[model samples]
Target: MTPGLINGHLHVSQHLLRGFVPLAVSDTSAYLFKWVFPYYETLTSREEGVAATLAGCDLLTKGVTMVADGGTVRHPGVVADALATTGIRAHLGGWSWDHASAPPGLSMDTTEALDRLSGAMDEVAGRHPRIAPLATTIGLGMSSDALLEGAKSLADRHGTFLDFHHSFDAGEVESHRSSFGDDVTPVEHLERLGILSDNVRLVHQIVSTAAELDAIQRTGASVVRCTGTRAARDLAELRGRGIPVGVGTDTVNVSNTSDVLRALHVFAAEIREPDSDIPSSGLSADDLFDMCTVGGARTLGVASFAGSLEPGKSADLVMFDALRPEWIPMIDPVNQLVLSADGGSVESVWIEGELVVDRGRVIGVDELALCQEAEEAAAGVLMRMGARARIGRRSLC
Candidate 1:
């Protein structure tokens, strides 16, 4: 049994939007402003619940027992309710953005944004004690300085983690430099504001420089990198510097899958590219596996409670079927796990000493019915958002 894999970052609300957004490889702005924001604006609380349930069910079945949800600006209670039903451990919260250009009905001033986040935390903590609060800011470019400070302060006060996107694209870095009017990079800017810390977890960071990497290492801040972004060298460099690095399946519309094993496979292959100056012996299959298990747990600040098979730790682990064809020639266990196996080989999963999946099937949920529900929900949401017309169809379903 391996430690139950932790998804370092995910957006459950976007699960239904998989394949609905036609994204170009380099177009981050279109992925966010054109499709994601519009889709988010059209979601009701009920639909959010459906989406969350579908996401949680899929992740749990794939051996992800815990996730750190990058929240939407609406209906976090519905997210928590869905997590409760799926019996998945998660940190949940609402979006906190103080920018004037935020989507309609989603934008708030600094004070209002902070208040909304704090109130959501209190509400979720009181309503469902199991779901932890995740203090969030939209990002360095979109969030005001005051909002960033407030979000970090809130996380510190509540003893939780602060999550945000940072330096995910070169354009974002350029925009931040333009907005802040400083020659310093985005990571330096965050350092100047005292926002970088061990409790803060930044996502993407694909455009980071050496100085920024040093700042991250110095501040002890963690990073969650998505393999779909193809920033393999960045991930390896961070790991080499002894910084905590975790893997993430960004979003359904972005990475197109919640399978942690797939992310791990991509990460392993990318880091081992030929003709690289870095030695081939630098990263082993075991090291990549640790990134998904212990590294992810540490990045999420849940290492003491999960991550390993210790006496006092939670009994969270996955059992892969050794009898599968993928494991028939398993010469090196770690190598096979990292290079050959996918989520399909996951035979069973346990979280907090309770069996959530057995024999490759979720214990109680009716998956077939859930698929029907998800299809209906997806159709309804797309139609309501007027996104149906945007979908490019080449063949009849």
Candidate 2:
């Protein structure tokens, strides 16, 4: 049997783009404004539901009982309902993008954005307690950044955590350097905004320097490593510092569902890059396992509720069929899981002592039907935007 897995970070709506586009968009600026927002603007609540439900159902099959849906579209409540229907536990966040000079198609009044997010949270919270909806602010992760302060205030008022993408890669670092003069990194910016608190759950953070890492450690803030998309060294350094870090699949851009096993294995392999002479002996398979299960729960501040299979904790457990050819030796179950297990191995999944998925199938979902709906939605939206043919075409040459 597999331990209950907590998907520390994910954006459910991104599931529709899984395997449909390139892994990473080359033209991030044009893609975000021209294609992403324009296409997303066409997304209906039902469409978002279909995407979240499909992704959540897949997580059930992968032994992932919990997920932090980092941010949702306009009607986040609809996404929450989809998760409830799929029998997956989720922390649904209502995202807010408020700035006068924000990117095109993303500008919204600060007060209006907050109001909408609050309304969405109240609506989702009233529907299901498992769907812990919170108002979130998205920023480039710089200290004292406008978005960071807003996230802190909103989180305090709602008793919820603020999720932000922090120091994703070298490109973001350069942007921060350009926006704020030298001698300041993005993490320091978050510190200045009073956002590096226990209530903050920063995602990615691949580019944080040693000093910033120490700063985050001092704040007692948790780091969520999207190992599926991040370089392995990024996660290993945090682990070495004895910092609290969790693993995530990080949207369909990396993979469809937030399967912790995939993330852990990738992280382990990545830590052994050629340039870095770091010995991989100390980081065992179990260490990676811990990062996905208990480690994830700790990052999300839900350890008391459902990290391990202790008697009193909520009985969120996953059982994988051990009869597969991948289990040839089967000497160590955890090791076998990381090396061989995929979403298909999940045989049963339980959440809060309830049988949410049994026999590798979500309790109340039709996989084929959901796929068809999602396909139709994607086509409809793409066509409506008058840019259907340019979906994944790039003029890199």
Best by lDDT: 1
Candidate 1 regions exceeding 4 Å error are 23-26, 275-281, 389-397
Q: What is the TM-score of each candidate against the true structure?
A: 0.93, 0.90
Q: Report clash pairs, candidate 1.
A: none
Runs in model 2 deviating more than 4 A are 99-105, 141-144, 228-230, 273-281, 387-397
Error of 2 at 178 (Å): 3.5
Clashing pairs in 2: 142-189, 142-190, 143-189, 143-190, 144-189, 144-193
lDDT of 2 at 66: 86
lDDT for each of the candidates? 0.82, 0.73
